[model samples]
Target: YEFDATVKKVEEAMLSEGFGVQLITGIHDMFKKKLGIDDYPKYTMVLGCKPQLAKRALETSLDMGLIFPCSFTIYEEDGKVKVAHVSIMKIGAEIGLADKEAMAPLIEDTGKQVRRVWDKI
Candidate 1:
């Protein structure tokens, strides 16, 4: 119930940010049977990709799949909509590629876009 309400909240927030939100709702069965997130509420992930920035990042590193687009997951936690981004900076650091100064700004910008979405919620 609250989870559904949260999607409305996120949708409103995304509209205010001038970014479109794509809600992935077809993975519930997979999550329950395969991923073992049975007790977890259905997950709604918003793919927030800025066109110019993403294109620039693509130009920067062809192998930059590690941080192509940013995503934030909204789920019910204690009857609240919890939004969180999957940080690519941390992933880059884990893989020892965080030192790429050229990619820093791109990654930061992606982070900012995702943050903007979360901020509105």
Candidate 2:
């Protein structure tokens, strides 16, 4: 898909999966205009969040906010648009959450929703 199309699809997908797009950063444009580097491929970062899930995680651990507003990167590479996101499960373990079991559902659900967003595109 083209860059704009992919971005639109991703935003729509996130909304359908109960995640709201909090922000989008146009890395390619920023680098080109600010740093005067125009050779970079198109790239954008999408920040999304589900309020209830965020609330639940916060209740479990204030530190969880560090990973709040999950991010997805959409970039053009090899003439194709690709999407990627950090693994919440890995983050949960990395932060050494005291209640992994309690956070498992939120982590898994968030990951699944992200997958759904990818699938939609």
Candidate 3:
């Protein structure tokens, strides 16, 4: 898929899954315009949020905010466009939270929604 088309699809999927795009950072363009390097592949990071989920997580532990606004990276590789994100399960485990029964559902739900966006595009 084309870059812009993929981006649009991702945005739509995120919204449909109850997440809102908080910001989009165009890494490729930044490097080109700032450093005059035009050889990089297209890449952008989508920062997203689901308000209720965020609120609950933060209420549980303020430190959780460090990973708030789940991020997905849209980039081109070998002439194909792909979307990638850190695994929420891994993140939770790393922070010693995934093992907690209460945290499992939230982590799973968030991962499901994020995967839905990737699959949609």
Candidate 4:
């Protein structure tokens, strides 16, 4: 039920945000075929980045490979699908940054985007 609920939330969010949904084969398919991660519904990461954020991030860092923008993955864990979110800013800080102010807004916005994504999930 949790997995189904999360999937539904994501679908509804995409629709509300006017983004298209791309459903790839579930992870179990690969497991049954190769890695043997069977019994779990694993799937490729669901990607949904707002155009505005994408544009801003690109303008901020031509190489802001850090903020490519993606969604938390949904996977079967302990017999349930769990949803999660990761932020580049969070990850970047762990690394090192010279300009914190310039990066602050980007990270803030990223956090907002993540929250919105979670709201849907």
Work out the TM-score per prediction: 0.66, 0.86, 0.85, 0.69
**Which regions of candidate 2 are displaced past 4 Å?**
none
Cα lDDT tens digits, model 4, 42-88, are 65456655667566656655555564545556677777667666775
> What order do you get sorting by TM-score, best first?
2, 3, 4, 1
- Best by the TM-score measure: 2
Q: Tell me which residue pairs clash in candidate 2.
A: none
Sequence-dependent TM-score of model 2? 0.86
Per-residue lDDT tens digits for candidate 2, residues 2-65, read: 8988888888888898888999898999999999999999999989888887787888788787
lDDT of 1 by residue, 43-108 (tens): 777665556665665576555556645566677666676766676644664566444677678667
lDDT of 1 at 115: 77
Whole-model lDDT values for every prediction: 0.63, 0.81, 0.78, 0.61
The better candidate by TM-score, 2 or 3, is 2
Error of 2 at 39 (Å): 1.7
**Model 4: how far residue 35 lies from native, Å:** 3.9
For residue 91, give model 4's deviation from the true position in Å. 2.8
- TM-score, structure 4 vs. true: 0.69
For residue 15, give model 3's deviation from the true position in Å.
1.0
Give one digit per residue, the lDDT tens place, for model 3 in 1-121: 6998877777788888888899888899999999999999999988888898787676656667776778778999999998888865458556775345666677777767777776676
